[model samples]
Target chain A: MDGFWIILSGTLIAISCGLLGAYLVLRKMAMVGDAISHAVLPGIVLAYLFSGSRETIPMLIGAAVLGVLTTVLIELFYKQARLQIDASIGITFTWLFAIGIILISVFAGQVDLDQDCVLYGEIAYVPLDLWFTASGINLGPRTVWIAATLLLLILTFIYFGRRGLFITTFNEEYAKALGLNVAFWHYALMGSVSLTTVVSFESVGAILVVAFLIVPPATAYLITTSLKPMLWLTAFFGFLSSLGGYFLAVWINGSIAGAMATVAGIFFLCVWIFSLIKQKQASIPFRA
Target chain B: MNDKTAIEAHNLTVSYNRRPVLWNVDFELPAGQVIGIIGPNGSGKTTLLKAIMDLVKKSSGYVKLFEQDLEEVRERISYVPQRESVDWDFPASVMDVVLMGRYRKNKLLKRLSKADRDLAAEALEKVNMLEYSNRQISQLSGGQQQRVFIARSLAQGADLYIMDEPFVGVDAATEEAIMLLMQEMKKEGKTVVVVHHDLQTAKLYFDWIVLLNTRLVASGPKDQIFNEALLQEAYGGKLNVLSKVGELIKEKDFPVREK
Candidate 1:
């Protein structure tokens, strides 16, 4: 029962990450999510300094503020300084992450954030710490419920704003010309990504969280060019990786989050190889 | 000439990095006219279109659509960017691209109505691309892809259409098909502005010609501006000498002079 719940929690988190990651991938902002995840550390540390507690709500609020600020700062650099977008992202996130690392080291003894917990999380122990009571049923891990709710919110946003997101992703200039509030959409997307990252940060640490945000959706991108299929495939791949990775972690006596990330990496590698083979096969006839 | 001018630009000057691309470009098109904008590469033809569409920031200029600001008259205008400008492998079908035309009219959070779909189908039909509506964009041939873009513009149902090099890299048949569609648009009292190349077709296809070489060389009826002198000024002038001299200077230490 414990193993089942553990895997279930992992799968839920993976599905949520993968689904939102699809939009990030489509918008070519996958690295932005990575940057945001790293940049949120300062916000987390700041919230702890202010509130003196690791409560979920204040931490999430702080993270969201910094996430939005990171995006805005990147945009500002791109627009005002005429810097290349990738460079701005790299510079901004690295600086913020460095600050976070310094803060963590300075306040190491006082805070609950340890070095090991920051790199790789204790997801297997999540079931031990958090409990959920839904109606008459008692759930083992609170992470599962939180991840599921976040996933549902993301899905609803995507569903309702599908056309707007599609048009904006396809051609931002065109969408703007047609009077779609592109700025609003962009910030909304960034905010949602930040929210997801912060919510899942406990169950999966920042590094594996990045893998969750990137790998599954990227794997789906290899198979199809259509947004709908990519979304479905991303979710499917994420769920499989989570379940498979949890088992693999148990088998190897390793961290569950790390193993799950490795599973996603393996899936991405397999898809990449399959795509290469398919491309080669297609080119063979032309060569002949 | 009709009293209704479809597009009017006043003192349109655009610069990039403080380098002027267009200098005080002023022109107007009478309604229901097929205006061809011809220029050598980097002659600010595309920049002129982008500035007029408000896609590019102008250093000092104003563009009017139906005597109003472009933003105010957006729904009455359609734009078709160059084929090279977009990612063909983007996850959209032929119809999906065309359906984006109706996006301006749809309410927020609303699915594309059946009427919008039908309009897209009808636009695709205008370009003889109704059958390819379901096809992925990358699967389409260059000409077919160009037609799909044109179909998207047609689906906008606007009175003024701005197309950036619709015929570049397309087959003759596709070019003819696109021209016929443009002709049809003109016949329906819509104005079409095309950024065109191929000097020969300039005489055959366009009714009005705006010859540009970094500045407005001439703007009038094709018969008035299509002469050898204007062509020489627009295409032959100092650019050839500058380029030739530049290349020679690159290879040799001294300037090259022709005998």
Candidate 2:
């Protein structure tokens, strides 16, 4: 039963991140997700400190606001200050993340968080946190519920905003010609990434969250040629990584989040090698 | 020329980082002619097109399409940006990209109807890309991709089509095909404005030409504006005296282009 909940949480987080990750990967904004995941640290810490309780809503709001701000800052620097996008991303996230670390250090007593919690959340503790009714009926682990809700929200956002997301990502200039609000779609995706990062951060931790946000989608991107199939394949790879990571962690008696990220990396490597071989075979036959 | 103005710009100036790229440009393109924006590399031909499409901010002046504001007539305008501007490795098939043309202001939240898909297919057929509709954009050659972009613009069903350097890197066959398509569009009374780089083919391809070098040098019918003095002004002293253009301007039969 405990194993079921742990794997379920990881899988839900994986699918959500993977779905959004596909867009980020296609946009060449994969590292933006990583940047947002780290940059929202200060917002997450502040939200937690303000709420003074274990709650998801406040943290998500903080993440959303900070996430949009991070993108806005990146854009401002890239456009206004004439900085290259890569430099803009690198500078923005590092500055915000540094502030988060300072906040944690300065308010160590009030934050009351173990270094392990912030660094790489312990996934094994997921089943330990349970939500119960007033009638004393145990529904399930609170972490699983949070993961499920976040996934549902992301699914809804993707479903309704499909058209806008598609054209804007494919061709921004064309979309601008069509008079579509390109900025809206851009910030919407960024806000969602920030929320996903924080929600998954509580149960799965930062490394695993960043890993799922990029690796599975990138792996799917390597093999698929179109968007629809690429998305389905991303979800499949996300689920596969979760299941494989659980077993791998149990066998090694090591960190679950670490094991999950490692498995995702392994999948990426194997797929990459297999694809290179396929390309080589295809090219050899066509050579004159 | 048609009674309706296709594009009207007055004192249109665009600057990048406070340095004006397009300065005090004034011109009015006719509704049905094939117009070319011709200039040197940094002469702001693309900037002029972008300004007309409202892609860049103009420091002064404004552009009117069909004598109305751009916002009121967006659907009547189709913009084909530089072919190399978008990432070809995008996760979409040629058909998917073409279908985006059928998407509009009103259909933002709904699925494209069967009629839209049929129109997209028809556009692909016009470009000889119908069979390659399902092929991923990443798998296409430069010419094929350019054709797909034209197919998308065709699907737009717009009155005024603005293309920026559409023939920059295409093969000879693709160039011929595209020229034929443009002629067909002209026959159908649709307006086309292209930012052209090749001087050798500019006169033959465009019915009218707007020469630019920071400021507008001249804009008129090709026969009226295709003079050595105007060309010299637009190109500064960079015009090659022994080039084919000089011979053509002198009304001498230059050697036939190698087929």
Candidate 3:
């Protein structure tokens, strides 16, 4: 039962990451997600300092806001200073993340954060945090509910605003010309991505969070060209990777987050090999 | 609508990093005219279009459509940017591309209506691409892709259409189809402004010509302005000798003026 809850929660987190990751991949903002994932540490630390608690809600909110701010700052630098995007992302996130590292070292004794746990979470123990009602109805870990609710919100937004999101991602200028508030849509999408990243941070950790956000969708992109199909495939790939990685972790006595990321990498490799084989086969001559 | 100028640019100047690209360009296209804006590379032809559309910020000046500011009158004007400006591999079909044109009319949070779908189909039909409506945009040929973009503009259903090098990378048949479509739009009393590169087709297609070389060299009826002197001026004064010879004949009060 505990293992079932762990897999379920991990699957929910993966789905949330996949849902927001599709737009990030389409916008070519995958690296920005990586940067934000790293850069949110300081916000998390600061939220802990201010609140004097390790509650998930405040830390997630703080981290999400900082992530959005980081994205905006990157855009401002790109637009106003004419800086290259990669350079901007590297400069902004590295500085913020370094500051986070400094803060964590300075306040090491007081805060519950450790460098190892921030980078790779203890996913094996997540199910141990599950709570039950008076009737012993298991409610699962809090991360599961948070991830599920975030996934639902993301799916609802995508379902209703699919056309707007499609146009905005495909050609922002055309969307603006068509009188769509493209800037609003951009920020909204980025905010959703940041929110998902921060909320899933505890379950997946910061470093492996990027693999969850980028790899599944990227694998889906390799297999399909349509957005809707790619999204469905990405969710499926994410779920499969989570399940496979959980079992692989149990088999190898490895970190669940690391195992999940390894499984995603393996899935990408399989797709790459399949595509190469298909291409090679297409080039061969056939005897009648 | 037929009598008023569809587009009017007044003293428009655009620059990049203090280097002027378009200089004090003033022009107007009367409604229902198929006008060609002709200029050499780096002669501010595309810059003029971008400035008019407010895509690129102008250093100084204003553009008006039907006597209203460009932003306020945006819905009445449709712009088809250069084919190279967009990623062809973007995950959208031809029909999806066309439906983007109707986004302005649809309310926020509202899905595309059945009428919008029919309009998209009809626009694709006008470009002879109704069959390719469901195909991914990257699967289309270069000419077919240009037609799809033209269909997107057509779906906008605006009074004025501004196209930037719609003929680039297109086959001759596609060019002729686009020209015929422009003529049809003219007959329907819609103004079509095209940024043309081919000099040979300039005289064959456009009824009105605006010769630009970082400025408005001349703008008027094609027959009146499509002459050696204007072409020389627009081609960066290479034909200045011919103009000088005509000037000498006028000074000598000679007849015929060198044909």
Instruction: Give the top-scoring candidate (lDDT).
Output: 2
* Positional deviation of residue B50's Cα in model 3 after best superposition, in angstroms: 2.3
lDDT of 3 at B91: 69
Off by over 4 Å in 2: A48-57, A107-120, B1-3, B241-259
Q: Please list the residue runs of candidate 1 whose C-alpha ends up more than 4 Å from where it truly belongs after superposition.
A: A102-120, A132-137, A279-288, B1-3, B236-259
Q: Is candidate 2 or candidate 3 better by TM-score?
A: 2
Supply the global lDDT for candidate 1: 0.82
Tens digit per residue, CA lDDT, model 3, B82-195: 887787887678888898888863575787789988998999999999998789887887789899889998998998898999987777799999999999999998999999
Per-model TM against the reference: 0.90, 0.94, 0.90
Q: Tens-digit lDDT track for model 2 on B49-147?
A: 889888899999999999998998899899998888998988899999999899887678898899999999999999899999999999988789999
What are the chain B TM-scores of all models?
0.89, 0.91, 0.89
Q: TM-score order of candidates, best first? A: 2, 3, 1
Q: For model 1 chain B, where is the 10-residue window of minimal lDDT?
A: B250-259
Question: Model 3 off-target regions past 4 Å?
Answer: A105-112, A118-120, A132-137, A280-288, B1-3, B237-259
lDDT leaderboard ranking: 2, 3, 1
User: What tens digits encode model 2's per-residue C-alpha lDDT throughout A1-288?
Assistant: 998999999999999999999998878778887788778778778887898754667866776677778988988998789998889999999999898889889998898755455545678899999999999899999999989999999999998888888999989999999888888888888878877877787688888989999999999989889888888999988998999999999999888889988999999999999999999998997895
The local distance difference test score of each candidate is: 0.82, 0.88, 0.83
